[model samples]
Target chain A: MKGAARTIGRDLGRIFQALAGLLFVSILVPLIWGEYYAIPALVVAGLVPFAVGYILTSRFRDAARPGKLHGMIIAALGWFCVAIFGSLPFLLIAWTVELAPPILGEPSQTSTLAAFTNPINAVFESMSGFTGTGLTMTDNEEVLPRTLQWWRSFIEWIGGVGVIVLTTAILARPGSGSLTLYESEARSERIHPSIVSTVQTIWWIFILFTFVSILLLWVVGMPLWGAINHGMTGLATGGFSITDNSIATYDSVAIDFALLPIMLLGSIAFPVHYLILQGDLRNLYSDLQTRWVFIYMGIGTVLLTVLVYVSDTYDSLFTAFRYGSFQFVSAATCAGFQTATDATNVALGRWSAQAQLTVVFGMVVGGAAGSTVGGIKLIRALTLLKGIRFRIADVFYPETAVRRLKINGRRLNEQEIRQEFEEAAIIAALWFLFLGLGTFALLIMLPQGEYTLENVIFEVASAQGNVGLSAGITGPESLPTLGKVMFLFNMWIGRLEIIPVLVTLRAVFDRGGLYR
Target chain B: MTVSDIPIVGDLLESGAEDRVFDSLLLAGPVLILVIAFLGRSTVTVGLAAAYVLFFVAYVLYLGVRR
Candidate 1:
């Protein structure tokens, strides 16, 4: 147990160090913007965690090597730790902006940075940013200083790739349990033989895409600053936006449509992208998840367009299809980018229940497993669908029948089949469980007349699915403390896909040996 | 040997016709909706979309036979 503590502490410390290093890099944002007040805030946030990390690592240097369970604990706890410490910037910035009022003579009175002074709200915003669930506490993001906006986008960009991957790729030494840590972050595919190499390749691929995404957006008439932030968040599938109304502020269908490819690019598994990038263009069509990405997004777009058009939500089929296609892909990819902002410029709150429900299905299904998007993921959804057919067909088979299950070109024996099926079923069941609990929580806690059951379900699914398509429920001070906390926990568990969170909880309760 | 016996090439060409069809479907989906949205979902727009679909189908069939 002492040995376990030492190893766990060491891993967590490394994660903290990685986080601090990212924050230290972030100090340059405030520097560039001439926001002198933000510098110390970022520094304090960076140094505290860095100091804590250094102490723990140095104290636990000779601990036994961490195992799989340690990886899960580290991932779950480390994410929470980062989110907690990550809130410091939001908190300190809020206070500094309030007290000091932006020494750079930047926009002061209108800034919504004050909302983060509340610890719960601060943590909620931080959690939302780090989880890549872009549900925000601030009502007006346009008034937020450039430094803060950069922080939000930067964290989402990193969070999309995951801090653990960052830690493994840059911080942790090779053969230092990188594989388990990487796997624990719910990343299964290894693009390279070494886990470190795989993470590095993923980062390289991400960086290349980010630059291209930025350039494309800029060429399409978005200003360079907005383009840079949108490019990062869009490719991350992390929908944090600098503007108050999100991408809706532009109200240009061309820009709305422009982000679709980048968002879809983010929704795809990195390994698939790697294959296509490495000249295996055939994988674009043949890869199971990639094919499904197109199919699901297409079907969803068609269905949503019809529903919105028939419902007369947008007053015309053109407008309906515009919002429908973009919003559907945005939701399905779990990018949570906004195109559903109608002429009134409100979000999906005005849409019919059927339309919102359609988006909810997208939120729950999310994108591919290895992608940054959240929710139950397509692999599990496909597994459950196939499992149903396999079970039904089993009834007609003879007692001595020898059957092998196949999925995505892989043959599975009996145990493998059962394991995959069970895992899929458990995740699906748990996803519904979390969503149900979240909706129930909001139902009792949230004020009435503002939102309906569909809206509540949509909001909860967005939070639990790590999709940030809100229906006017989430806010900094507007929501109850308990509700904010609920969303914070929902986003946390959702980003980790429920298992790591539950594993951490169970392990905490067990008090037994981590290893069997 | 025939292409199927050489695994790698077969995998690479794994129904290139089908992939083309898939690509067309993907491309046509947005175009179909956009045409309706922009030009209205009138008979002309519907005809255009249907024409694209039919063309892709015919092309797939032609390619299938040729290969």
Candidate 2:
């Protein structure tokens, strides 16, 4: 028991050290922007974890072997701590702005920082950023300082790939614990044999894509700062925007076009990216997940366009297709950017019920597995669909006949097929169960007759799927404390893919639940 | 080769047109409510809701008969 505790501590120490490094890097944003007051806040935040982690690592260095159970616990706890630490910059910046408004050199925006002073709101924003959920507590994001804006986008960029993966790439030496930690982040398939090399390769691809995206956005007429911030969050499939109106504020088709490919690239699995990088175009074309994504996008776009046109939401078929296709791709990829109209504000909120439902469907389906985006995942959905077909076919086949289920050209034996079906069913059931529970909770908490049950379900699904599309329900100021907390829990669960959180909770209450 | 020989396409074709129609309706019924609600057609909403409920009842009966 003592040894186990020590092992947990050492693993936690690695997480803390990673947090400290993130904080240290975060200081550069404020320092460069000449927001000196925010620097001390970041430094203080970094120092606390750095000190504790240093002590823990020195003392418990021997306790280094952490199995799957430890991995889940560490991931859950690590993310929780990172969210708290990430909130420091927001909290400190808010305090500094309130106490000394002139230090930031923007008097008009000083009042905006007061929103972050509330611990719940600050943590909610931080959690949203880190989980790549892209929901914001700030009512008018345009008023936020450049430093905080950069911090928001930066954390999402880090959290998009994953915090544990980042630590493994830069901090962890190759070991059993390192591999377990990497797997705990919901990334099982490695592009390379060595976990370290896989991490490095993923980072390299991520960095290369980010640079290309930024350059493309800048060339398409976005300012350099806007391009950089949007580029990071865009490729991360994180929907956080520096503007009050998200990507709608740009109002440029060129910018929209530039962002679409970046979102798609981010939504694809890293292994696919590596294969494509190795010049395997055939693999890219043949991959089941990729094919499913294209099918979903094609069908969804056509359906959405027709619905929006029939509803008379847009002026013409051309406009309908343009907006419908963009929003569909965005929602499907789980990237939250929306094309805007001058009169309607966010065109998404103004969409008809059928169009909104289409978007919600896309959000629920999400992107490929082993990607930054969140939802049920195409792989799981495919498995569920195929499993049903297989079962039905089995009923028709002769008892003596051999049956094999295939996924992505790989045949699954009896045990593998059963396991796949079980996993898909279990996760899908849990997803809907939680979605229903969250919608019910919101319905009870929200006032009657103001928001429809459909809208409530849509909002809940958006939160749980990490899609960040709102139906006029999820503003920081307007949402009650319970509602905010519920969404926060949903985003955390969604980002971790629901199982690890369940495993962590089970391990906590049942004691030996993980081992059993 | 027949459509039934294709992979995912084959499965869908084998499921029969009746199953396909029912499956699509099952998926789209709730969404139809949202559409009606958004349009603010109260009379249409009532009709749609009644139809949706009836569709479910029929589906249950069909499943029972098939079993």
Candidate 3:
């Protein structure tokens, strides 16, 4: 028991140390940008975690390696800590901006305090940023300080892959429970032989993608600042945009096309990225998940285009197809970039119910597993599909007959197939069940005639799937307290891919299960 | 060979034949209620929504036990 406690303590210390480093790095944004007044707040945030972590690590010098459960606990606790510390800057900046209006820029109609005055709103924004869910509490994003905007995008950039994974890539020493920590983030595929090298490779590729995306966007006529911000969020599959209208503000076909590859790269798994980098195009073409993604996008886009065009939602077929394909891709990839004609109206909000439902389905299916994007990942979807096939095939087989189930050219025995089916079914079931519960909760809380059930379901699924396609239901000022809490919970669970959060909850609540 | 002894389609058919009516009813109950709720907005819709929720919860518990 003592030994286990020591191990847990040591693991937490390592996590806190990583958090300290991240917070300290965050301080540079304000300092470099000459927001000197916020420096003290940032410094305090950095030092507290660093000091506590340093003491714990020093005290627990002889701690043992962590098991899987310990790793899950570290991930859950690490994110929780990061969210709290991350909110400090938002809270302090909001307070400061409220006190002295001209320090950053022109004051907006809404007080800056509205962004963070309620501590829950600040934490919600921080959590949304870190989870790569683009839900924001900032009513006037354009008027916010550049420092806060940078912090928001930066958190999502780091969080796109994962915070713990990033720390594991950079700071985790060799053989110090590094693999367990990596696995805890629900990433099992390693491109390199060692966890350290694999993480490094992933980060390098991510950086390359980010740079290329920025250059492409800038080349396509976006302002340099917007390009940089969008590049980070896009590659991270994080939906936060500086403009209230999102990607639609530019209204350029070239810009939409430019974002496509970056969003695709963000949604594809890191291992697949590695393979493509190594000139293995055949694997990319033949991979089950990749094939399914293409098919889904193609079919969904076409159907949605037809639906929208027939409904006369847009004036031209070309407009319908353009928006239809963009929204479909965005939804499927779990990248939340939306095309808006004006500040308040998004293209998605104008679509028919059937058209919107297509996007919701895409959000549920989501991007590839081992990618930054979230959903009931494509791999699991494939598993369930294969299971259905296997069940159908099993009915005709003799009592003694044995059939091998294959996915992506790899065959699975009966036992493995059964395990896969159960895991896929349970997770998918829970996803839908929670989605229903959240939708129902929103329906109860929202005032009559204000929002439709379809819009509520779309927003709920967006939060639950970590797909940030909003249908006018989610906004900084409009969301109810209950709605905010529900979405916060959704983002937390969705980012962790449901299992770690569940394991952490069980370990915390079930005393007997903790030791086991 | 008999139809049940054939491949693919036969197997699917056999599976359908083997499926219990009670299980099918359990699966369909919530779906039907949800559809009804979606089609209209009234006291009946509210009742259907409640019924759907109850059915969904029970079905999830059933799945947990079966697993």
Candidate 4:
């Protein structure tokens, strides 16, 4: 017990230390803006975590190497702590700095940054950002301080690739059980054989795409800063935006179309990206998850366009296609960028129940498994679908027939098939179970008659999926403290893919303590 | 890797002819955006969109055939 606690605590220290470095680097944002009032908060947020992390690691450095359970615990606890510290920037900036100096852009009458003064809102925004779920507490994103905006995007940027993956790539000591920690983030496919090299390669791929995305968005007429922010978040598939209404604020068909590829790039697994960059572009179609991502995007877009058009949500098929394609890709990738509900295109909340549910389907399935998306994931969805067909076919065979299953490219024997199917089945079952519970809670928690049943389900699915396409139930005013807390908890588990959070909970709730 | 016995996944990774057609559709998505982004799509956009749908349907039908 002591050994487990020691190792988990030590690994968590590394996580905090990495966060501190990121926080310190972020201080440059305020410095550039001459937002001196915000500097102390940034410094303190950095120092507190750094100091705490320093104490823990130095105290526990020589502890036993973390086993997988310890790694899971560290991941769960690390994200929880990171959200707390991550909220400090929002909380402190809102409380300490007034709008008198007015950090950047045209400050609103009531600054959006002020919403963060409430700890629940602060941490809620932090959790949403770090989980790469773009549900915002802020009413107007542009009115927030540039530092806060950058902080939101920055966390999403790192959080999309994952904090553990980043730490494993850079801050981890040579033999500190990087593999288990990496796996704890639900990341499995590696670009290289060595874990460290694999993470570093992932980062390189991330950085390369981020640069390209930024330039492309800029060339398409987004200002340089918005390009930079969106570029990071877009490629991370972390959908935080600096503008008022996300991509809708720009109202540019060019910008929306431009981001489509960026979002898609993010939705593909890093290993596939590596293979393509390494000249095996065939993986684009040949890789299982990659193929399905495009196929889903293609089919979902068309299906959604028809649904929207028939529902009379849009004026014409072309208009329906425009809104449908962008929104579907956004939801499907779990990136959550929205197109405007202009005169031609209707917003999702106002859509027919059938039209809205189509998007819910996309949100629930999400993008490729090894990518930054946060749902049940495509691989599990594939496994579940394939297993059903396998089961049906098995009935046709003889009772003593040798059973086999195959998924993606790998052939699986009976035991492997059972294990794989069980994992997928359990996760899918638990996903809908919690999703049901969340929807039920929100049905009670939300203001009566304000939202439909589908709206509540959409919001819960968005939160649980970590695909932040809000149907009007997320905001400081939108939900009470309990609801905000619930969504944040949902985002946390969703990003960790539920199991680690459950494990961490079970370990804590065990009759025996976390440590002996 | 034997592709025959796999259920839905087998339709993909079926090799040669099927993969080539599907790749065109995959490549088409991004390239179509580039076309619209540079030259704002008018009637040609709608026409291209129609062709895109055709390709998707054809690709599905082609590989979706039962062995």
Quick one: how many clashes does candidate 4 have? 0
User: What lDDT does the true structure give each of the candidates?
Assistant: 0.82, 0.79, 0.76, 0.82
Q: Which ten residues in a row have the lowest lDDT in candidate 4 chain A?
A: A100-109
Predicted complex 1: DockQ: 0.02
Q: Model 4, stretches more than 4 Å misplaced?
A: A98-109, A342-345, A511-516, B1-67
Q: Report the lDDT tens digits of candidate 1 across residue range B1-67.
A: 8744665334323322225444334334444544554665456754665465456446545644554
DockQ for every model, please: 0.02, 0.01, 0.01, 0.03
Clashing residue pairs in candidate 4 (N, C-alpha, C atoms within 3 angstroms): none
lDDT of 3 by residue, A168-281 (tens): 865677898889888888688888778887787777567655655665566566765687789999999888888767888888888887787778879888887766544455
Query: TM-score for each prediction?
Result: 0.87, 0.85, 0.84, 0.86
User: How good is the docking of model 1, by CAPRI class?
Assistant: incorrect
lDDT of 1 by residue, A1-516 (tens): 678789989989998998999899998887877877788889999999999999999999888777888888889999999999999998988877677654535436444777887888889888998898899998889888788899899999999989899888777777888988898898899887788778877876676567557656655667667887998999999899998788988888778888999999999999987666544666767877888999999999999999988887778888888899988988887788776665344369888899999999999999998988998999899999998999899999997898889888899887899999999999899999989999998999978776799999999999888889988888875678999989988998999888999989888877765555
Q: Rank the candidates by lDDT, best first.
A: 1, 4, 2, 3
CA lDDT, candidate 2, residue A229: 89
- What's the DockQ of model 3? 0.01
Give fnat for candidate 1: 0.00
